[model samples]
Target: MSKNIVIIGASRGIGKELVQLFANNEGNHIIALSRNVEAMSEFDHLKNVTYKAFDLSSSTVLEDLTQILSEIKSVDILINNAGKLVNKPFLELTKADIESCYQTNAIGVMLSTQVVVPKMLNKGGHIVNISTMGAFQGSVKFPGLSAYSTSKAGLVSFTELFAEEFKETKIKMNCLCLGAVQTEMLEEAFPGFQAPLSAKSMALYIHDFALNGHKYMNGKILPVSLSTP
Candidate 1:
């Protein structure tokens, strides 16, 4: 059956790859949401795909969602990949930066999923939260990664908690703790940090995950890294 998929933070990175991957499949209807729709212009030529640009932090998220969703009947999958991270020393990190990270990475994901999960209840759905591998092992010494790691950690927790809340539903939840990827976010966060996974490879992983990972993967944090060992 054709599936309606909602992808938040779809302008770039893993989200962008998902837009491309899902678009390749004829049965998928994709809704790509980001703060700037222009970033997704590459997919403009594709059919069965729609775009929405809005600040997830804005108070109008619910209202904006209602308007957009009123036109669509349902979504079979929700990918919360929108996130912000600031790499700075604990002392140098500003209150605004910390709060912004939490809001975007953790709170924004929670609120956005809340808007979509109910629509999926009648027909079991999958919710994939894009997190970071930094949350897996302690990164206190990873240089200026305090805020980033913490927010991802919070996201992992949120995924576990939310999964428990839906015990009665066929819907499932999982966290994709992605490792370094060649994305603007990586460049901006690590400047010159080299990654083993290219955006294309990352996108492929997302496609496979959505197609098969959700079947036996719920309430778990899955890591995607470059190392072969």
Candidate 2:
């Protein structure tokens, strides 16, 4: 059956690849959200893909999202791939840095999911939150990810609690603690660090997970990486 899938942060990297992968299926209807929608205009010709410009951290996020959701009516899957990474030493990080990271990575996911849950409550749905291995306690520590990792840890905890709170409703929620992937975000955060997984490759795995994960997975923090962590 065709599904209505909403992908946030769809302008580049994994989110962009996901839009391409889903659009190729033809049966799926995709709504791509990004801060700069113009970057996604290349996909405008595809009938299955619709693009929207919105910032996750904006004060008007809920209002903007509600307007978008109104057109779709129901959402089958929500991919919270939007994130902000501030690469600064712990001592150098400011209050603004931490707040910005939390706002975009943790709070944004909460607000967005809240808006979509009611629509998915009756029909059942899946939510895939994009997280990083940095959030893992045992993972190799990077020097400049204090705010980024802390914010992601908050999201991990939020996903766990949200799953329990809505378990009876059959809305599956999972966090994918991903390893380093070759993307613009990674390059910006760690210049010249080569990750084993490419955005396209990782997107393939995420594609399957988003479509079928609800069948057996809920509240699971699954790691997708080659390194031991």
lDDT by residue for model 1 (1-229), tens: 6899998889988889889889888889999999888887878898978988866777677777767777777788888888897988889999988988887888777777878877988988888888888887653237687887888899899889988999778888889888788889989977887888888899898777876777887788887776411
Highest lDDT model number = 2
| lDDT value for model 2 | 0.91
Reference-based lDDT, each prediction: 0.83, 0.91
Clashes of 1: 0
User: What C-alpha RMSD separates each model from the true structure?
Assistant: 1.8, 0.9
Regions more than 4 Å wrong, model 2: none
Give the clashing pairs for model 2: none
| Model 2 quality (TM-score) | 0.97
After the best TM-score superposition of candidate 1, give how far the Cα of residue 34 lies from its true spot, in angstroms. Answer: 0.3
lDDT (tens digit, per residue) of candidate 2 on 50-87: 99997888898888899988977788999999889999
